[model samples]
Structures are given as C-alpha cells and as structure tokens.
Target: MKYDQIDRKLFIKNRKNFMAQMKPSSLAVFNSNDIYPVSADSTMPFQQHRDIYYLSGVDQEESILVLFPDCPKENHREILFLKETNDHIAVWEGEKLTKEAAFETSGVKTVYWLKDMEKVMFELMTQCDTVYINTNEHYRANVETETREDRYTKWLKQKYPAHAVAKSNPILQRLRSVKDPIEIDLMQKACNITEKGFRRLLDFVKPGVWEYEIEAELMHEFLRNRSKGFAYTPIIAAGNNANVLHYVVNNQQCKDGDLILLDVGAEYANYSSDMTRTIPVGGRFSKRQKEVYNAVNHVKKEASKLLVPGTDWAEYHKEVGAMMTSELLSLKLLDKADVQNEDKDWPAYKKYFMHGTSHNIGLDTHDYGILTEPMQENMVFTVEPGIYIPEEKFGVRLEDDLVIQKSGEPFNLMGNIPIEVDEIEDIMNS
Candidate 1:
C-alpha cells in the first residue's frame, strides 16, 4: 500500500451502519480479494475488496472480517480472521499485521488466525440465524473471473444449509453511496495529486509528443505523491482518438492542431478521484475548437448545479441532455427540426454527447450508488459532459468531481485545476 493510513473510525462507522440495517441475529462475512496469477509463479498485484476495506481498515490479503452484531458472546460480535504472520513471512514478503496491530488499525478486539477460521465460523453460525454474504452488485460491474469472496460464499452456504442467506450488497449500496468527511478528505487528496499530474502536462505537451509520453508523466507525478497509480485505465487520446470514449492505446503522436482528451484520475488510500480535461496539443485551441470547448464547459457548469440533494440520477441525465441540445443548436450542429423530430428515447443531442453526465465516485471510479434513488447530501459524483465530433476530427470533454450539499450548488473537488480557456492557454504558453 503506497498511500497513507486511513482513519479507522470511518471503517468502524461503516460496519456499524451496515450491521444496523441487518436483520436481528444476522451475521455478515467479507473476504479480501485474491492475488490473481498471471502465469507461472508471477501474479498480479493484490487489490483488497472495497467492501471489506470499507467495513474494516485491514488492507492485507488472506484476511476476513465477520460482523455478528447479535452474537451470544460479546467478543464474537466483531471478529477478524487474518493469516498468521511470523518472522518468516517478514523475511520473504513483508511484515503483515499482528494481533495487537490489527486492533489498533481496525479497532476490532478479537482476532483469529486463518487456521482457526472453520472452528470459529462454526461456533458463530450456531449462534446466528441468518448469514449475510458480500457480493458485487455495482451498476457497471462485469466480473467474469470468480473471486475469493465468491468461493467463500459458495462454501459457506453449502456447509450451513439450515442458515438463512441474505445479500450484503443492497445494504452496502445504500451506505457506501454517501461519503463521510474522512472519505471526502482522502478523495480530495487523490484529486489534488491528479491536479499535479494535469498541471505537469500543460507545459510538457507540444506537437510531436506521443500520447504514451503524457501517460508516463502523469504516472510519475502520481507515484511521487504516494498514489499506487491511476484509479482506472487512463485515456491519453490525441486527435481523432479523443472521439473514442474509451480510447486508451495512447500510442499516437499529438498533432499541432488537434485536441487531446485526458480522462485520468489518481487514487489515494483506496478512494478514487475522476477527472477529464481536453486540451490543445499546440498549447492553444483553434477558434472553432474554443467554441465547442466552451459549450462543453458551460454544460459541465450547468450540470454541476443540477447535482443538488433530492435530484434523481435518471432525470439529471435527461436535463443534461436538454442542456446539451441547446448548446448544440447554438453551435449550429443541429437545427430546429433535428430536435423537434428527435426520438424521445434517443435525443438529437446523443449524436454529440452520448455518455451520462454524472456518476457516483469514491471507493471505485464508477462507485456504488442506486441510480433509481434520489441524490443525497455528501454523495460524491462526477459531472462529465462531452461533445465528440468525429466528423470535425476532434472532441471536447470537461469533467469535475462534485459533492452534493443540503443547499445551494454542489462543491467542485477539482476546482483548483485549471479549466478555463485563458488559464490553460496561459499555463501552456507561459
């Protein structure tokens, strides 16, 4: 873990909140993600499951957290099962958490080694009526590979046939959707690191630089700032490449007259910060490019205002679409008939701006939140609106992470980053 330690109170509160929503006598189990093997003895880096990390501040592999709020024994109510660590593991890999250290890190009093998991779990199952299983139910999740949690869940249900099963995702979806002040501060740090990476490119970018070069620069900044790396796959698309929403090849040369779209963010302490800013390769936007750029920026500003508490995620996109349509009509990209005859299902504005304007952001890039529910204060979201004009050989997108508030407009987390036409130009040309 390259990031700093997070406050344990956040995890403590998260567990308490999730347990509060559980049925009486119900217990929940969470497992750390597996260290997936690539080939041979080599393996991909370990990434702790966000849910487990949210519930407990433990960030190690081969760890499990069990929450049995109504257990007969008081110590059994909150327990942690971790892999036994000794001086041998310390010599080979690294020093893992010990019993006393685990208590300090997660505030869990009772800790057991993995070797005693079955015995302890059997004792717990006998005391609890229902078992809660953690599963991935995020809106954008497409997990094909079976995870450790999946395997553990399968075994748990099979071994304890009489125990009732309940899904932990629904409770987590509602709880993780809102952010605590500590989580917000951590995300702000991630965004600030991303800001450094973005600012580094303003003067570094010029004609003839490869897209991969820009990606490298951003990585260097993020790593130096204690970030493990990008929160997601980075998109350093240049020229027509920017038109492709998920373009990440980053192999093209940045031409003089083309715009480069950078959809990148840095992660700090497992919290994510998402930001997208398109800039000119030659340190300045052309007259027409600035026109479209301002339109996208204007739409971004207006959309942020719409992220107030009680707003619906589905209706917010529709409102953003209407706003984009007006901007496109003013840009002469669409006429009156294009909108009048537009399909209600697919509006005329879809031709240019296709993706949703905002999504919840925190633990994951596309963080967990029930889109059907109304927005709430302290919920973080990304306001990204773009116009991809492949015919014009360019595209423009401006995005910022914002937090919904009880009153007034949402607060912009990336407010310190340069976005205005003159500011970007001055920074690049200075």
Candidate 2:
C-alpha cells in the first residue's frame, strides 16, 4: 500500500457496530476480491473488496473475514483468513501480510491461513444457526461477472443447506454510509491530493495543450502526493466532448476558446474524493462560457446546502430539478412551451443536466447508502451540477465532495479547490 497505515481502531469500531446489528447466533462472512485476469500471463491490479477491508483491513487477495459474536470460543468470534505469506512470495511479489501484521492492521487477534479455512469454517458453521452473506446490492449495480464472493456464497450455501441465510448488504449499506471520523480524515486527505492535482493543472493548462497532457499533469501531482490514483476513471473532456457525461477518451486538442471539463479525483487509502471543475482552455472563458459556468456553479452551491440531515434523496433531487429548471429557463434553453409539454418522467432540465445531482462518495466512488433513508450526519456525497450545451460547443460542470452535518449545512470537503471562474482564470494565466 502506498498510503500510511490506517488506525486499527476504525476497523475495530466498525466490527463492533456490524456485530451489534447482526441477528443473535448469526455469523457473517466477507471475501476479498479476485485479482482478475487480462490474459494468459497478465492480471489486472488487485483491488480489495470494500466490505472485507472495512471489517478486517486486509488489502490482499484471497482473504476472508468471519464474525460470530455468539461463538462458543471467545477467540473464534472474529477471525481472519489470509493467504499465507512465504519467502517465495516475498521475493516475487513483495511482502504479504504476516499473521502479526494482519492482527495489527485489522485488530482481530485470531488469524488463520487460506489453507486452514475449510477446517476453521466447518467449526464456525456448526456453531452458528444463520450465516450472513455479502452481496452487491447498490442501486446502480449492473454486475454481470460473478465475483469471488459469489463463488464462496454458492459453495457455502451448497455445503450448509440447513442454515438460515440472510443478506449482509442492507446492514453494510446503512453502516458504511455513516463515516467514521478516521474514515472522514482519510477522505479529506484524498480531497487534499485532488486539490494538488487540480492546482497543478491550473498552471499546466493553456491554449493548444492536448487534453491528455492535462490528464498527465494531474496524475503526476496525485502520485507525488501519495494517492493510489484516480478514484474512478477520469473524465478529461474538452469542448463538446464534455457534453458526453462519461467522456474519458482524453485525446482531443483543447482549442483556444474552449472549456475543459475535468471530472477527476484522487483516492487515498481506499477513500474517494470526487470533484469536477470546468476551466477555460486558453486561461480565459468567453463571455457566454462564463455565463454557463457560473450557472452550473450556482446550481452546485445551492444543491450542496440541501445535503443536510433528514433530507430525502428523492425529494432532494426533485428540489434540485426545480432549481435547475429555473436556471435553464433563465438561460433560454427551456421556454414556457417546452415546460408545458415536458414529460414528468424526463424534466426540461434533462436535456442539459441529465445525471443525479449527488451520490454517496466514500471507499467506492459511488459509495453505499440507502436512497430511501433520510440523509444523516457524517454521510459524504458529491454535489455535481452541470449544463451541457452541445449546440454551443461546450459544457460546464461544477462538483465537490461534502459531508452532511448535524445542523446548518453540509461541510464541503473540496472547499480549498478553486471554483470561481475568475480564480481559475487568474491561476491559469499566472
């Protein structure tokens, strides 16, 4: 891991909270993600499953965590199963976590190797009446590929047919949504790294620079600042490419008069910080571009204030839609006739601002949170509002990560990043 070790207390507290929520005599299991294959001899980078990491802080492949608060033996209550580390692995891939190291990282005293999992799991299964299985149940989840967790779940169900099965996703979705102070600090660090990247790009971007070059500059800054890398695939779209919401092909040459929409962020210790800023490619926004940029910025600012506790995700979005509708009306993009004939399912603002105004942001880019539940304190979210004017040959998106506060308004995590149209222009020109 490039980042410093996280305080083990975070994981300890998280486990306590999860165990508290579990039904009595039930055991929950979490599996690490597989290091996916690219080809015969190549493999994609190892990304730890967020739930496993949340419980055990084991960031390696082929790891497992079991929690049985009402186990017969006290030591067997919380166990970690890791791929055994050896000198050969040390020489080839680097140092895998030793038992002592795993204990330190996860705060779980009972640790076993992958080879002993079957024996250990058999003992655990015989004691617990119910087994909690982790599954991907995110609102936007569209997973077609079966994960390592899926395979383990299949095996466990087939082997333990008599045991009562329950879903762990619901509990995790509620728990992970509320940020621990330590987790919030890690996310703040990620936002700080992202700020460094954005500030570096301010100096690097200018007329005639390729979009890919700006992407390079941002990556350089993020790496130097000790971030693992982008939280998600970056969107370095310039001019009309910005109109495409998910544009990631950063090959276009940033023309003199166009705006570049940089929807990028850095990840520190698996915590994500999402930010989007549209800056003038030539260090100066045209008169009309500034108008659109300010409009988007205004929407983002207004939308962020709505992220306080007790706010309903659905109602919050509808309110934002109304605000955006008014802005679009003022911008002359939507006329009275357009508003009158607009479909209720697809509002007038959908033409320009199509995506949701905000989503939970944390360990995963689109982190876990139940949309039906009222907003709560310490829940982090991304407030992104954009106006894509394809006909005008540019788009504007302003976004920042924020933490829902107990009272007043949500706190902006990316508050340091320059967002003012004049401020971005000044830094670029300087």
RMSD to truth, every model = 0.7, 0.8
lDDT of 2 by residue, 289-367 (tens): 8888888888888998888889999999999999999889988989989889999999888999999999999999999
Off by over 4 Å in 2: none
Q: What TM-score does candidate 1 get on C-alpha atoms?
A: 0.99
Clashes found in each candidate (C-alpha, N, C closer than 3 A): 0, 0
Query: How much lDDT does each candidate structure score?
Result: 0.93, 0.93
lDDT: worst 10-residue window of model 1: 1-10
In candidate 2, which residue pairs clash?
Answer: none
Give per-residue lDDT, candidate 1, residue 293: 97
Per-candidate TM equals 0.99, 0.99
After TM-score superposition, the amount by which residue 86's alpha carbon in candidate 2 deviates from its true location, in angstroms, is 1.1
Task: Indicate the worst ten consecutive residues by lDDT in candidate 2.
Answer: 290-299
